[model samples]
Target: MNTVTRPRILVVGAGFAGVECVRRLERKLSPDEADVTLVTPFAYQLYLPLLPQVASGVLTPQSIAVSLRRSKKYRTRIIPGGAIGVDLKSKVCVIRTITDQIVNEPYDYIVLAPGSITRTFDIPGLTDHAFGMKTLAEAAYIRDHVISQLDLADASQDPVERASRLQFVVVGGGYAGTETAACLQRLTHAAVKRYPRLDPGLIKWHLIDIAPKLMPELGEKLGSSAQEILRRRGIEISLGVSIAKAGPEEVTFTDGRVIPTRTLIWTAGVVASPLIATLGAETVKGRLAVAPEMNLPGNDGVFALGDSAAVPDLAKGDGAMCPPTAQHALRQGRHVADNVIASLRGGPMRPYVHKDLGLVVDLGGTDAVSKPLGIELRGVPAQAVARGYHWSALRTNVAKTRVMTNWLLNAVAGDDFVRTGFQARKAARLKDFEYTDAYLTPEQVRAHVEGTARQE
Candidate 1:
């Protein structure tokens, strides 16, 4: 009897798309068919949608972090690292592990789903001073920092210092930015009551975006509704305005207004992961350009999806590419998994097609707005649908239960307004959370697998 070697399938990233793809592949393929491996820096897939809630203390960090280890149906070997580079010709991936170790992983088939980092511009002192909301650490840190600011402001005798400490600024009008501003603003609103010495009127929040409108994808009526809700809550909404320079205690806006604020939360825009560039392949913007089936054209057995790939929007046509959203990424993951299986079995691959399911924006508490299946809803009704969708989408029962329990417990008991000392009073900036400089250059990436390192 001749023994056949099973092909190695390497999936990069542990985001919504990558995790979904690995799970589907495991369920559909038998052990004899292929050996599967995953590359990620963490053991859990952080449910990104609930991160703003986590920052606001409505949800705990663990509740949003879905574990990658506990799948009963499939066992995919997990690599606790970020993929730094890939050599397509040699079929190798260079990874930098959590402990700073360089490792080479070989694969017959590769799926790139590594998500995005916060997109920033050339504003002076922006990177040095601004805080990011893209990671678990950043969210946790922001919570601590926000609480500390309230504490410091309450204790300060000087009015100028108190005003600066009490004021908060958030940039970006998209889902992430809007939710972050709303949620964190609510946190201060609720937290102010606990401090007897603090004046509630001093707590100010400013949400700004360079775009002309706030969440334009939500449509005019819904977007205007969201704006009115925030305005009613005392959040200053500034459209077509952005910071030109960021100082230690003040931010100078392009519209010539300088706001004295100690807190700057940047949830604005995002660019695809740097790993896609290592392939030396064609890319749409920063994202790798792929066929409708989510496979790199002319690159046999290599597939890409999620925020990192500009997958053609076959449903919309007219050379339109699918927007990098979780709704699309989740569907694309399962679809791509089936395509990978088809490639392995010499079967036909199908193009990924899915219409939008609508949008949801949870603004903390019972204040929410959603357009589920084209039905517009706001207030308590929208909140129900939004939370229900997120609860249902959670991969495991434990995560779902924890999230529900957190929601119920928060509603009943509320937050304690105590700083956990997770981060210091001085904020960690954008560059701290996003290690964009960590990626290996294409030449070095090629050298790793080609055994040309020693000569160089």
Candidate 2:
């Protein structure tokens, strides 16, 4: 009898990196050589850059998500699960299914692409009071929340309560934070036209951060320009400040300035998933440390990429790791696939090297700032380039068309800030979605195994 031999490649997470990695793997490996399986909680690749557009009602939720099952170029299995733990020694990954069932899958080669999660601060009431801008549900909820607040404010008899409802505070001034503020502010501006009684000035939008300027990574010139545009639009830019405390109807900032508001959108920052900590590997600054080839040191069959991995930057001098950005993640994923193929076929692996290709900040209302290849551009031209870059960066034509269509519609029909009121009362805070150590530790796993061993 002839023995059947094939390498099993298991890729965790369906984010930008994992999806692209799987795509390249399917292209490089023949069906007879390997069986590729992509494990993720969702079956869609989320276009995170356009998430603010979804929240602002400029685009539908489905517009920002590309279906994984629709890819016909590659023959790959999509396993729906969030990888919680991995035994590198045993080559077994423990994944938690959506139904809360645990399954152990053995693989010849493992790719760790489990993406990052929102980083929260120790500020009191931030966990309970603030809304996060990470996922589609959160973005959609924010849309409803913002519109509903305006609707309630317009109808309220109490002036203080109405004022509180009208004021919206956004924490953090990073790309996500800035975009969310700009998009949501434009949304509120258009939405208030429906309510004649409400004063446009009364509908306040505050963007606060501990940093000295907005979008500091965009550098001084572009960052200043973006901040100025936002300020001109009546969106208050509070630099070197943070929300000291948050209450149900009011927020106190570090500057001792108190603002009465019902909405607090948190886009502070993101840290590597707790899943990375479970890998039992050396990590640098919360990311799994990997060589320039995107392979785990001391492990031949393991690799990692994207926000979860701290890949060494060969382009930069000694001791520099690639930043957790989509540009690097996408490139890393493709390179990882190439290296993996090389490993399987007895070839050399190339190190990842790419120059920083500037940053772009879309400030809504035909205002944007971009520094592509060190050439800074601002205003409508910058907006054009920022959007064009995003459109070109998308993996598929369908996504590009959909995004362009949304943009065209926005330009023609303006924004529709209608509230769907989904997840109105449910707690959708960052802490609520956080995967705590209490449930992820070995003790919990042991208890779970002990209880479910017989059941299994």
Candidate 3:
């Protein structure tokens, strides 16, 4: 009797690209043709764009965290772990399981989509004093921390302490920083109503960025429109300036200006996943270098996408690589799956080419700005477009329903201004939340793999 061998495919990370790749693979290939395995610490794909809403109590975390196991049609075996290293020559991936067990996952083909980490600078006290807005835990902690500041300020008799507590400084004018400042500012605005003893005039929000413009991707016209909205809302906008030093109670800008504040939210930018360096391959900026089809050059059976890979933008056609965005990630996920299957079947592979759809910035409430397909829109029309795009992008029906319901509930009932006291019990800092120190070096990777092999 002759037996047929099936190919095994492994996908790392459960972000937008990873999840979409698995979904496409499950739908395209039969169970007898290949076996699919996914490596991730969490079983859910976080809708990262809505994270600011989660931070501001506009939506629950569960609503944006779409479960990977929700579909009965999903047949991929999920390894509840994070990939720490990859040996291209050995075709083996080193994964640290949630239980802290190190294991090797060998595969016929592997996809790296580990995603990005919050980018930080070397400024003094930045890592120790600032809070990040890159993950769900950080968002939740920020919400709690913000409300706690209000609670503490309300109870304080010291004028200086109260003033410091009421002042907020957000660094970064990109989409993440801008949205974060806008949403959390709205949170404080509504929250102050509950604190009758607190002076509303004392509450201040300062948004500073090293860039000359806010949301520059929105273009000059729409970007200025968004900035106007924020400025009208009393948000202090500072361009071409950044934090020179961060302290526990105050931050000094490079312009030699000092501001007193207990809260500092950092959303400056993101760097490609540290796992990219494990491959020791060519890289663009910090992302792994890959063909337009998302295949790693000179490395057979290896593919990369999402924030981890520098994929060429064939649509623009001027040697420009695709910008790291959810739009590109989602499309790249599906396209890379197709290319992988082509490789498996000895068929032709297609290159990834996509055009920019537009940009959207929701500045809390009905205030928003958007440019869809080059049509500039602001106010209520832009809000509709922004919400419409997000609603359409949600992966599951349940997530969509939950998010919509949360939006409606938040609109009708308003935020309750409650803090869960998470930051009070533990320190919430950049390093504390991101775990940047936990990643392994190349030497450590080899040692761990050899040690595990010896034990086995």
lDDT digits (tens) for residues 120-197 of candidate 3: 889999999999998999998999999999999999999999999999999999999999999999999999999999
Candidate 1 Cα misplacement greater than 4 A, ranges: 1-4, 424-426, 452-456
Please give, for residues 1-456, the per-residue lDDT of candidate 1 as tens digits.
112478999999999899899989999998889999999999998989999988898888899998887766567999998999999988889999999998888889999999988888988999998999999988888888899999899899999999999999999999999999999999999999988998899999999999999999889988999999999999999999998999889998899999999899887899999998888999999999999999999999999999999988888899989888888988998999999999999999999998889999998888999999999999999999999999999989999999999999999998867778866555577788879999987888998877744543
- CA RMSD of all predictions: 1.7, 2.3, 1.5
- Candidate 1, residue 359: Cα displacement in angstroms equals 0.3
- Evaluate all candidate structures by whole-model CA lDDT and list the values in order: 0.91, 0.86, 0.91
Error of 3 at 180 (Å): 0.6
lDDT of model number 1:
0.91
lDDT of 2 by residue, 100-208 (tens): 8887777888999988888888889988899999888889888998999988999998999999999999999999999999999999988899999898889899999
TM-score of each: 0.97, 0.95, 0.97
